[model samples]
Target chain A: MAPTILILALGCAYNEELPEKDILGTVIVPAAAATRLQADGTTATDPRFIGPIFLGAYSGIDTVSFGYPHPSMGPIVTADTPGDAFPYGGTTVGRYDFACYESLACKVVTGRFSDYNDMLEYFGTVLGSPIQDDNGADVANGSTFQQACYDYFYATSDQEMAFLGDLDFALNADGDFEAAFVMPHTVFVEGMTIWGWMDAPEIVPANPTESGGFSSCDVSTGREFDQYDENFREGRVYFDALNTPSQYIYAGDWVASGAEEAVVNSPDDKPVVRLDFGFGVGEAE
Target chain B: MRTHGNLALGALLALSGLASGCTNVRDGFRPVLTDAPFVYDIGELRVIGAEELAGVDPSTVPDAVHYGQLGAGENAGLYGGATFQFRATGSSVCVVVDPEAMFWNKEISTQSNTVQYKFEDIFEDDGDLDLSAGLAAYYTGSPGSEIGDFSAVYDDPAGVEHELAFNECIQTGYFGDPAHAGRATVEYCDIDTSLHSGVMYTAVLETFALPIDDSILNFGALAFDGRCADLPWYDSNGALLAGASECVIPNEVEYADANGIPEEKAWFPELERAYCSGVGKVNTFCKDNPGAGCQSEEEL
Candidate 1:
């Protein structure tokens, strides 16, 4: 009834439109080999080759414990942008856009990450969660409960150094650097769950990128599980929780004992690793 | 008299095990190779929810039964039933079917509503030497009559300790299969369900998550290596769950028992499918319940 109120109401009813179009791009890397060929022509010898970059929107779903399909965070996406065909590392999984919301909506969806960049970023986030519980780490697989690391990801910081693409295990018979073979696996970052493969550089390399990612990933001198046992045992080895809760994080998937064994997949190909994962990312030596 | 009795028992078992065999995973043992896709074994089953499903409520039962008994990390949706997976860790739980319980040999009376049946009449005894007491296959008298009476303890993220007790008889058998020993799968099926999961999922991530033709239900089974005779069924006691039976030479995979019966290894057959009273109730919810919209397994 008031003129100011009526004018405000009329203004509120106005709608704005913007022109937008969906963009498409493809990463070409045919000829399946140990080395992942990227569309940028830069071979992804690291685990980041597996795409589906997950940008964390929230801290985590605060459930008392972590279970399958752990509570979802908001605005999650498996693609680089909405509806773009992301590059796939393993070649077995396809591309898709995933938006899982913890509130009112949660999906136990499964897919492989198409790029390694997203995965490295994710690892950085996990290595950085304050107050991670012990059971929150890999349990049921026979590793005892440790107090400091709490979970498997941080407990084995030195070993995960390889997962970050710092260590290179894939090699040829001649002892030359072979292309790194990666396997997509299900990982839990705080509450959001995604299917990403673990990859670490077998060789120590000069660090690069915004935060330069992780240093443990560089194992150029060759790695021996024996060396990292104490580091992993002591939880304080790899990731640092010294950062803020938002920056802190822990993440990784269980190495498949059998093809059908890993919650990741059930394939007839009964290998030491489940079909969802691959061999050289560094299995329990 | 006791010495003579023991000697006689030994002689019988010697004659009983005249032959031994091996299992060929390719020939038949693979659960998927079966004609019907009953996700789990039907014989050694435990009926979980009494009509109200009050026993399995996560709120009341803080202790959780693991889902990877069959498949690892993943929940292999059984044909008889699917899973109740949590959105959090992908952890899942399924209907708690008693491993010792079997089907009713003879037709029993059905209550008019059909949804709820008298538990007493539903279970019948298998004609095995061990299952003697009339209706012996099932625990005496009531559902909780056979006191498995075991407790499982867990500590939460907050360092808060939690303990869960067995409501029914349960005994763990020694499975010679690799179990992938250090791995996390039950080497068979893991279908989980929960009240809070929001979705009643039935996807056999490791095996076959395909749909079946009709309604799905849980069944019992006697899963042995199929090499020796079936594991002698017994009431749930420390001896049974702990694999401490005379018929079961827990020490050796191949050995003879006191009864001259080769302590042949036995187990709940790989999880298969079966029809139970619960099917009716589940279907009722699927049909009337808008969210559940129960469909034939084929539709899953």
Candidate 2:
């Protein structure tokens, strides 16, 4: 039998028994030691790799032209890499994780961090923040000029703080990240563990300035190509496939390299896709 | 606090009107009334520091008007230009020429490192006192964001869009006034739970003259051959009222902190109402009723 896959949610209380509002949920399935019935009713053995199975979907994705500057990876993409623009067709482009697909509906694991700061720092590291822009300038210069700029940009008379706090509360507490991840339904890992988790794919374009014929390109900085195209983003399906019993999938990508044959290896492989169906914002699930 | 300062600034502006008529005599300068009834053609204004707009549809705008970048700001993108026309249809009534077409641009970045910002081209950054009051009100209230869909409320000719749903009316009030002078403001929004961050309260008043004869209402606009340039939005009180405004125009940003939660509908009303009336017009009905134009503190 497949190891029972459980879906866990993050960012809320577990005891209150509230409807999962965060819009993100996780599931656990059979690992190397088990097998789950696929949609086709065939049972397949779990595949093992150095990193989590979730990361396999986002491997080798690029990050430049997605908004923030691309991180430094040897022989990969970066901002101002002598390219016209990222082929995604926007001033900014990048990838992020959306973990609420129907495929992630097996066993669940759950965990929580101490506070918002811990979550932000951990998420930033995992999502890749403090990355140098094309000019090698990160946001944390802490220079007098930068501080002065920040001061003027955020003038004293403006009500920017209140509005911002409202946004933070919405994204953190009311956004419902917790309910989907708590208990046996989800898995809880330390913030450091998430930061140290394997990276997402780096998706580069065959051409830099122009659209690369394909609907999207997944960037390795863990930034998927869906954000640029409205249609692709709407159609995104995020799934977590568990291989090892105690493992969580962090990053993966659709690859032209040997991944296709690997995905179709077994008769019982039920591929999972995690879909973030716009929680409390747009297009609700 | 903003009220007293605004009153003082209003008095100063009234004084400037005495000497404004005699200065900068132009051939086109006709005898303009204290409250001139004329259609102010809103020129092309651009959004600053924006590279892309998420939800705004460019094709929604009609092709009759020629859109230009107003030659200002850095990398403002296609969603940059906003044009609005305000005409005094009656004695003191300024109805938006095209209410449906009236649009403002807003940008909000969830990343703390990248502070979200929106800018309106309303002449000088802080040349006249009215400009400052007008700008502060705009940022704090009018522009609203539904999750990532940032929109500027076009109800007021001088207002900026605010993302807060609960206190939308408060924003309309704070930035609704077009009379105060000499202020330009930018907001660095800290996403903290406190109403007052480490930085709080900014007040400045620079007086400018408005003639009582046939001419533009604002002297600064007259100097530039009629244009206010880029204006800002929001102020201290207005920010508090965003929760109040959200009662009417519900947005995704407002739903983040759902109702019944301690943080829901929480705000300073004294500041909200006082600031709304002092700066903005007297709501939808007051503008409809001629005698009800300006409301005193007690009457409101």
Candidate 3:
């Protein structure tokens, strides 16, 4: 007969339960850059890194152009390379995991991201600070630059700690990633091992010149495609893994990478981190 | 705290208005306040770096009345162009336009580390702002992704066929991606056309499609010459283009967030009545009036 092991209940409890009003919220990172309480590899989704990745709470969806050199930004078939533009009639020329459709079931749709003021508001509200921010305010101005979140995924105005890098939160149907969800703080993955923890921001800039067909205009690094050096970045590194040699899927600038989350140690083990969906502001769920 | 900064910027823009009228407003340039809505088409603006656009003047750019292909998307492929009709009867000027793809999924990648990246764009090896400090200055928006079919049907001026959906309002969302600038209301839209008395003026639309992903396109159009380029349907004389300046139009506008249902009758307060609505997306208007313009269950 198999032996039964019954353990005592967890003695720890969260400081406070997040309120439901913080619906504008979504979990950025389940836990800080560490293993969940489930230890390593003891659960179903560890080691290999199976994730129900959290794509922070956003109001809409969009698709920006690819970043090939100016010469290749125009109509084409498929994106032969990362720096080149994709063809106009390619069979699957798209990015972004839209959890919603026109049926009005989910909250997703077409939109743009060029409004400077709107971007600032997004970085402030959606990408709340969890790291460290003295100002505790949104840092989106072109001049007054500041980190918005901490390693744990909460709002912050200061950069007290060093930022980490991970793979971009993306996936497709095969990996059960096509259907995305805005996870609240209730998602507890404290001790579980996290494979692709994000330590940096994923700032995928567009091609530097119009010669490539499309131009990033403002989000560009000013460096021409001829001068594009993968080893060295012209701007801040958002997605750390992307800066280095990696096998992520991308046509022009749209990247779709698969990232997963580790399951819990046992059904009883609660998340070591508190459920702070809204960071320090907004109503917490 | 951010509100104060916005107010400061607003004040600064207001002051700039006093000096030659080059002040940039969040919604638009200080309202020209002409007899008819000043129409302008940003479609002709080249897709160049910020440095390239630095010396550009709004008036110098293209408008719906007269615009060039601008070489980049001149050929009708991914960066193809579309045309809209601006028919005005009496005092009503109705310009028909469409919105394109919101999000794009990149195609499967091939192993090609052979090509290298240019270090001259934003920063260099060590990390220093280059001559083009604000190269991305013109890059103000972000991308939006949806799980469903966010497709549209686009018919260009030359009888060409394309797919697109009408969208201009940035609805409040529950999830977000830093890569996105929030759902694009429209690419730096403007109205530069002038309205005349009894003389019928047509604010022709020049729409363009740029492939931002493997296949998905960024379908968008802009009206120039200053003619109320605000909602999907509107009348320069404030009588709603087709019927009235109804906040909710058909097949033209779409709100992303379902939870953000319309509270009142579309964005009536923002548009028509107040007419604060402009080229960008206004989800607040769609709230409570999702079916404001729907004729029957078949229309929805």
Please provide TM-scores, in order, for all candidate models, with all chains considered together. 0.19, 0.18, 0.18
For candidate 1, chain B by itself scores a TM value of 0.17
lDDT of 1 by residue, A1-285 (tens): 699999899889876432211111112211121234232334444423332211111122223222222212222111121111111112212222111111101100113222233332332332221112223342221123222223423444323322222422234454322222233331211222112222221221222212212222212222221333231212111121111111212222221111121122222221122113233332211
For model 1, how does the per-residue alpha-carbon lDDT over B195-236 read when each residue is reduced to its tens digit?
A: 223332211111222112111112121112211122222222
DockQ of each: 0.01, 0.01, 0.01
lDDT of candidate 3 over B1-300, digit per residue (tens): 001225556566668776866634443311122121112223222122222222233223322322222112211211122222332222322232223222111222345211221011110001000000001111112111100112234332222334432222112235542121222122232221223223222222222222222111222233222223333233333333321122222212122112232353243223322222432222222232344321222332
RMSD of 1: 27.7
Candidate 2 lDDT: 0.21
lDDT of 3 at A167: 29
Lowest summed-lDDT stretch of 10 residues in model 3 chain A? A99-108
User: What TM value does the first chain of each candidate achieve?
Assistant: 0.18, 0.18, 0.18
Error of 3 at A116 (Å): 46
TM-score of chain A of 3: 0.18
Q: What's the CA RMSD for each of the models?
A: 27.7, 26.4, 27.8
How does chain B of model 3 score on TM-score?
A: 0.21
